[model samples]
Target: MPIFTVAIPFYNDQNYLSKAITSCLHQEFQESFEILLINDGSSDASLKIAKNFRNCFPEKIRLINLKENKGVGFVRQRAVEAAKGDYIVWADADDVQCPQRLKTIRRFFKENPDVDICLHDCYFIDKEGRPIDKQLKWPKSFEENPLYFEIKRNYFFIGFSAQRAGLNIPFRSRCRDFPEDYDFILRALFKNKKLKLIPEKLSHYRIHGKNRSNRHSYTYRATKEILEGLNLSELSKMLQNSSCLKEKEISLAICELLMTKENFKEALEKLKNGNHNCFYSNFMQGVCYFFLGNNKDSALYFDRAYSLDSTEPSVQNNLGVLKYKMGEVESAVELLKNALQNKPDYLDAQRNLKVASNGRNSLSITKKPLRLSWVY
Candidate 1:
């Protein structure tokens, strides 16, 4: 058995598979590793590409060909089980590992036997496996036996060592659907696996539009699934199901995140059903209404908060500004003046008051509030 077993679950990624496979075959530690290519039901020329790898590196490459496509998670899990190396790893079929990735990951693992998993940062790449212009900083997990709950929440911090990416990056999912990588990570993490992150960017992640959307949608669906499978979910679910204020807060936060990067209509449905509101949401809703020219509805929500909370001068200031924009000068003056009285130096209130009292519509000040400003 090799010291490192690399598993890749491939589908129809013929365009970049050569780069991914060649990267592994030419690794500096090539003598000490084996590449297990799991052909998870590729309908394209991917299988043809795999056959080429086998033909060229017959001794070093192993292929698992399935007649049907499986989801990424199922294939990945199987790849792990099939691994014979001391360390098991995964790679995305289109990703490229830096020259030193294998060397660094192996060294890290040799020195830290307690670490079950280690990953490094990756630069987002184009279809050609070249680094794209943008680069993202990798997040590091906390030390001191950080809770898996916290770790899973910071999934962006996670990475699979280069060795893992070569073989297992292309996984087969039994679900006959894609988005299995998320499921694989969730399952492994939820089991309290030990994972370490290296902050250096050493891999190239490819960008494919369909892959991107499917990955995001899968993440949302899988996260919701994980929440359901959580042993501590009773507490979280209670918050979702309760009528209390904090419960409403938690419910709204999850709903909003779920809505993010998703269909807005679906998000609106969730908001309507939950009947939850926050100052920011109310503010945003009012802004949306204002843009939609639904001034009456916009003013209503603003006033609804106005009657509900008097301590938040910022909200009062917003209402004053909105009224001012709608040509209710006297009403705006009253609210703005009231905001100033409540928080004497709130800059927004002062600035809006200045613009309103000046009796002309011009570009408004676009900045955050400060505690010190004159009423002008």
Candidate 2:
């Protein structure tokens, strides 16, 4: 068996398929590794490109052709099941891997037998394969607990792994629009799997028009579904006791997950049960109350939250909405302006400001129950 299986899954990526395959073929590693190319019923020329590569290097490459166009979740599950290597390394069909990627990952896994997952950073490249000015890097706090960082941003690439391919396939029928990689990583983390980062830009991630993660609404819904399936309360307790996260951070994380599912009362209960008296706790409580339609308590909590951190944009925006509801137009306008000044790109604040500035007292015109910064 090969030491690594470089799994590349594609649908209609004829343009970049050859480059992606070639990058893997050009790996500097001295050990044997197989490149498993999966064709998800593509109508494009992607299949021909994959076949030509396989014919040229039959010993190093293999191809799997599905009769129907299954989504990425299904494709990934199939890849894991078919992979013959001890370690499965994922390389997107449109992305390019550095020549040293496999060598570095192999060395790490051989030295650290206890680690289940290994991740490396990537450089962002435009569709033309030219390097963009920016590279993606995980924060240092990721070393504390990868789950917390994953919740904040799905920053890591689906690169090297020592995980059992059969585990956490994320092939749920309800999670049709979910991020399969995010789901897989979260599942592994929840199982107390050890994750280590290589801190190297070992891959080139292509930013193109066909990227699925650009659909914010669909991504949000899918992420919500994934989070809902997990035992969040239990996860929160685990993080609270062992991870580097603070009490208020854990409470806010749980509240964010609950609120996204529209469980306002449950979120409020979580906040109330926690020993947190910080700004995030008060802000989340206010958001829950607002969503629950208990405007009086909502305003009370928003006021307390504002007192703790007056410059916070979410607090300002939420308070401004409450002021408009209470017929305090002038105060509402001022708070909304403050929120805009602090965060110019805040869509909720901008919308609320527009409505308030127009002398619109209608609650339907305003957006309320804005999430605090810590939630993301």
Candidate 3:
């Protein structure tokens, strides 16, 4: 049997399937590895492309054909179930692996036999296979405290980890709404699995219009699912060893998610148990009050959030909108201008600035509350 199995789940990805497969074929590791391509009922010529490659290297490639279109999560779960190597690595059909990818992963597992997972950064590429001058590095704090960092944001690449065979926890379905890979990693974190980060870009992540990470609806849904599964008692126990995470932070995070779900009173109640002096807690409290139609209380919390973290564009813009509602037009305009200065691409601030400038209060400030990820 091969030392590693690179599983690529395909679905209407004909345009880039060849490049992804070719990258795997060109690996310099010279180790025994098999490429398992699962065609998840793609209507396009993706299966044709996979067949062509399989014909050229019958001994090294395997193909699984599914007649019905299963979502990415289902396809990935099936792929993991069918993987036939000591270790399995996920390879998205649209992404390319580095020539040394397999070699690197195999070497890591060999050197660190106890490590169940390994993560690495990726090179972001455009649709035409050109590098896009961006690096996807995990936060420095992630290695020391995976639970805390994973909750904050997902930075792991699909091919970043090669797990040990027979690790039966299939990728969770609720993750289909979020980036499935992130949720998969989170599940592993919840199990307290040993994770190691290899500080090298071993894969090329192609960014395009079809990328699931770009969909707001999926993000909302996935987050909703994650929040529903979160328990204060369980999380407190998990973070006992984390350097940065604490009970207060976790409570406020849940509070923010509750506010997003429009459970304002419940969110406020949760906030009461957290550190009100914290920037994020204050910001979320402001959001809850704003949605509850208490402009005075909203402004108070917004000001506190701003005082704690003056550089946050979301905080600046939100406070500016509240100031506008309170008839502080000049202050609102100034704050909105500062927000734009901080983040020119912030649509909420830009729209609010224009409305404030035109002396119109028609724009709904609570229309799309910014996610915690947007706070900076």
How close is every model to the real structure, measured as TM-score? 0.59, 0.86, 0.87
Best candidate, TM-score:
3
Model 3, 1-376: lDDT tens digits are 8888899988899999999999989999787889999998899999999999999999999999998887788888888888888888888889998988888888888999988888777888889988787655456567777766666566565665678887656785642344677777777778878788887779998988788777865675676566556554666667765667666766665565466467889988878766567777787888888888899999999899889889888888889999999999999889999988988878788889888888899645532335444211
User: On a 0 to 100 scale, what is the lDDT of residue 102 in model 1?
Assistant: 70
lDDT per residue, candidate 2, 1-376, as tens digits? 8888899989999999999999999999999889999998899999999999999999999999986888787887888888998888999999989999999888888888888788877778899998787745456688678887676556545643435344543433344445877787887788887888877778888989778877766876677777777787678767887557876677677777787678889889988988578887787788888878888899999899899989988888888899889988889889988988988977778888887778776543222334333212
lDDT of 1 by residue, 232-263 (tens): 44434533443433555555444444433333
Q: For model 2, state the Cα shift of residue 205 in Å.
A: 1.3
Model 1 deviation from native, Cα RMSD in Å: 11.9
Model 2: colliding residue pairs: none
User: Where's the lowest-lDDT run of ten residues in candidate 1?
Assistant: 366-375
Error of 1 at 84 (Å): 1.1
Superposed Cα deviation of residue 125, candidate 1 (Å) = 1.8
